[model samples]
Target: MDKLGIYAVPAIIAAIVVFGAVKRIDLFEAFREGAKEGISSLISIAPSLIGLVIAVNMLSASGFFDIAAALLSPVCNAIGFPAELLPLGLIRPVSGSGSFAVLSSVLEKYGPDSIIGKTASVMAGSTETTFYAVAVYYGSVGIRKTRWTIPCALAADLTGMLFAVWTVRLFS
Candidate 1:
């Protein structure tokens, strides 16, 4: 005969619920209170989320991203990455989802085997979501210290980009 204790989990939960109700602790009330607290936090963070969306949209529309890519193209080509992935390097520092979309477009256009597409895929894996960092650091402390952040984050993004292209080209 095979022993079965598989039903014990639900039995234990039932016992706990019974004990709590008998003790006069209202479980539904407690759950509602916790959910209300979570909603309050979401409301508090709403402004920051909206600001992030607007800023990312503006950056994309400005054409500054393309200018950045063009400016960095020479250095990118020198570092063994295809010049086309320069926009990906620019995008990665500004927005994660945006960069992912750009990477997908590149892959679809060129196919993943092409140097540009492969380099972009590698860079996407290697880099951090830089705009999220700024939003978090600024939004948490209310710093608004936008001066030094962009340069520092861009430097880190560039380093990751170079490393990604180099490593991918070397190994693959």
Candidate 2:
């Protein structure tokens, strides 16, 4: 089974090459065209993505999230939310990488089997990077006025993070 996994990708690639040859399609040209389209899409989305990433990094570096987490910790803890997991929950919607860094820190400090770590992991898996997705997909298509999309997506992300805490507590 382990060997099967190793060979699967090569087998798939070989099959594709043979199929392309049989159909007399120019595989190299097809690959180049696909790459071109991908690059064009990247170019369209890059500016918004870069700005989002920079903003996230700036907020993180300025300790804004840390302060926010500290301020919200009491409210969170009263409702059975782990005070330590507040940062991960707060950042998960805005930036995937930022939330991942928070998750990693949680795992390191609390260990993976600990309730805080488990909740962080679950939240990371359950929530989407709402701002990142809005910036990428919406910006790619040139949609500037995301009136309701941001609000709705953020609400969904908050729901997911809350459920992650509840589910982990329930199962653990």
Candidate 3:
């Protein structure tokens, strides 16, 4: 299985090349065009990606996440959610690495078998990096008006987080 994984990508690439040849497609030209498109897409999304990274870093450095987590503790506890996982839920949508740090903290403190650790692991696995996806995909396409995207994505993230907790509680 491990060896198969190593060959899988090369096999896929070889298949694509054969398919393109069968279709009489100019592979080198096609590859060049795709590379150019990718670079352009990267250039288009760069500003939004940079801004998001800076904002996430600023929030982390300013202790906004810590403050928000502290403030949200009461609401979380009221709903039977573990307050320790609040920061993970908050950061998961904006930054994967940031949420990962919070998840690591939870695992270290609570142990993986603990309810909090299970919830954190589930939340991390289930939730999307909402802001990053929106910025990258929308920006790459030059879509400036994301009217319903933010609210809808956030609601989905919240649903995933809540379900993560409930699922852990229900199953464990």
Q: lDDT for model 1, please.
A: 0.74
lDDT winner between candidates 2 and 3: 3
TM-score of every prediction relative to native:
0.52, 0.60, 0.60
Among residues 3 or more apart in sequence or in different chains, the pairs in candidate 2 whose N, CA or C atoms overlap within 3 Å are none
Write candidate 2's Cα lDDT for 1-172 as tens digits: 3366479999999999899999999999998999999999888766766666676567667877678878988897788777778777777887666676667666876899788887888899877888888899988999999989987888888788889888778876
Quantify all predictions' global Cα lDDT against the true fold.
0.74, 0.80, 0.82
Give the residue spans of candidate 2 off by over 4 A.
Answer: 1-71
| Residue-by-residue lDDT tens digits, candidate 3, 1-172 | 3366479999999999999999999999999999999999888766765666566556667877678779888998899777778778778998766676667666866798798888899999988789999999999999999999899989999899999989888877
In terms of lDDT, the best-performing candidate is: 3
List candidate 1 segments past 4 Å from native: 1-80, 146-150
Task: Give, for candidate 1, the lowest lDDT window spanning 10 residues.
Answer: 1-10
Q: What RMSD does model 3 have?
A: 7.7
Clashes of each: 0, 0, 0
Candidate 2 backbone clash number: 0
